[model samples]
Target: MRVRTDSHGGHGWERETGGPPGRAPSAARAWARAAHPVPVLVVTGLTVCLAVSMGHSPGSAALVALAVFAGQLSVGWLNDLVDAARDARAGRLAKPVAQGRLAPASVAGMVLGSALLATGLTALCGRRAALAHLLALVSAWVYDLGVKATAWSVLPYLVSFGLLPGVVTFALPGSPAPPPWLVVSGALLGCAAHFVNTLPDLADDARVGVRGLPHRLGAAGSRVAAALALLGSALALAGAARLGGALGLLALAAAALTTVAGLLWLGSGRGGVRLAFPTVLLVAALEMGLLLTAGLPSGAAG
Candidate 1:
């Protein structure tokens, strides 16, 4: 993902440099600029994986990506809007709107429009996909509204990831059913992401009273959580693949090994965001690859 610089840097810096207090509108504008597009990237990536795994046509995949992006855009906007105060307090220089670069009302309007578009596009995927997206949307809203501040922050990430595979499955033209293992893998991926993603901001979050799962657990706890979640996901995938057919066990094993390698790297104190985020992204891409290659003729060996 590209770095989204918060627009508040200039004005915020000026204020902190002994200028007058910044206006709320400046903060909101900055927040909007910073928080936008995050959903598009994450949602689009997941949709692409689904399209590949389900063997959807390019056009169909693009449409699904659009819908997913819209949904996530709505979710991301609300997240920043609701957390503006907290972000401001936390000295989150990365949030443009929160730092006073855009208006909250304008951002809300954008979110509403995007949500409407998402709802319409979801219908094209059929009722199943729409329902799944609805559930995920609600979960995301809950997470942003106040859930992230509680012990349940991790729950949203897990649910979001789990729903992603389902979204891909249902968005296909035919009745494509995602394997139970795939869903489990998505959940595990989400859990790992939750832990690793929070590592960089744990200190800032704690200072701002955002005691999320990572903040509560601390760095060590977060690492342990990432390890357990990834391992569990691998076990589930392996078991499911073995049961589905003995041929894919090797693929599952490879995924497990890759996950273990990543965990080892993360365990090393030297690992940073550049290492962790890319590692997780690669692992996710590999899982999606395994799902796509499940029925293809291959010579992959454990």
Candidate 2:
């Protein structure tokens, strides 16, 4: 998020101005400076939720977070690297890579090392878990590489999020898939994320020749899709929570109401409400994840 500003007041990947000096490797080594950590944290938080929901040990939760961090870091860095030129062209100042504050080589090195570490950590989680999580990572990479320009971009998010619950469940001794509702709700949440996240970038992306689903849908269509997806996720969570009695149902209702309130609040785009839409959906997704955990079998071991 720390962009090196160009004379044109844009990120400077297309220009040499404000770029880190070639000899100053130290500049590229700063973790906080080289990349935006918000998305990484969000993804890693989901991994932690997975471990906890599956009744895994604390160590497992930490390990899951670490593995997810690696994969998210690699994919996120790749996104920046691959889109540096496009971002510069779009005058985006939010990408460190596009700003030239971060060296592509350094970011690429991090990607390689983190991906290898992610593989090992996921393997430690168990072979089935490893495969599922790795597939999720691959799906992300596919989006970063070439899929983002196509209408099929939503496919990766669906694949990855659906596989995520399996990753957690399969890490146990029996290697079970998560309940059907869990997978369905998770995928819906992810699909909603695709719409919501892409809505802000639709114009910029289309300008840069990236005609993903959001671009094709246009602003209004994308918003409708995102809203519908979120509502569907809420219903799925509510259904899953029904078996747990009134308390669980109450929680689910609360989450749904929150989602509705968010939609209404976002309608006004009051102050920063529009900017908070993604975060609101993320919280709802986390609530849905918690509801999914309610049905986890007692035998699922730490």
Over 1-302, each residue of candidate 2 has an lDDT whose tens digit, in order, gives 34456566753443333555772454544444444576677777776766776677788778877888888888888888888788888988666777675667767888888889998998998999899989999998999998988989899989988887787777776777677776877787788788777766766788889999878887666666766777777677667643465666676667665665555445434433355456555556556455455645526422
Q: lDDT of all predictions, in order shown?
A: 0.70, 0.72
Supply candidate 1's per-residue lDDT for 105: 67
Report the lDDT tens digits of candidate 1 across residue range 1-302. 12223455543423433545555555445544555564458658867866765677788778878888888888888877787777777767666546654456666887788888987898788888888877877787788888888888999988887887777677765546667777888899788877877787788888878888888888777877887787787677666543454455566566657655665565546455446655666666656556666631111111
lDDT winner? 2
Cα-based TM-score, every candidate? 0.79, 0.82
C-alpha positional error of residue 252 in candidate 2 after TM-score superposition, expressed in Å: 2.8
Score residue 201 of candidate 1 by CA lDDT: 78
Best TM-score goes to which candidate? 2
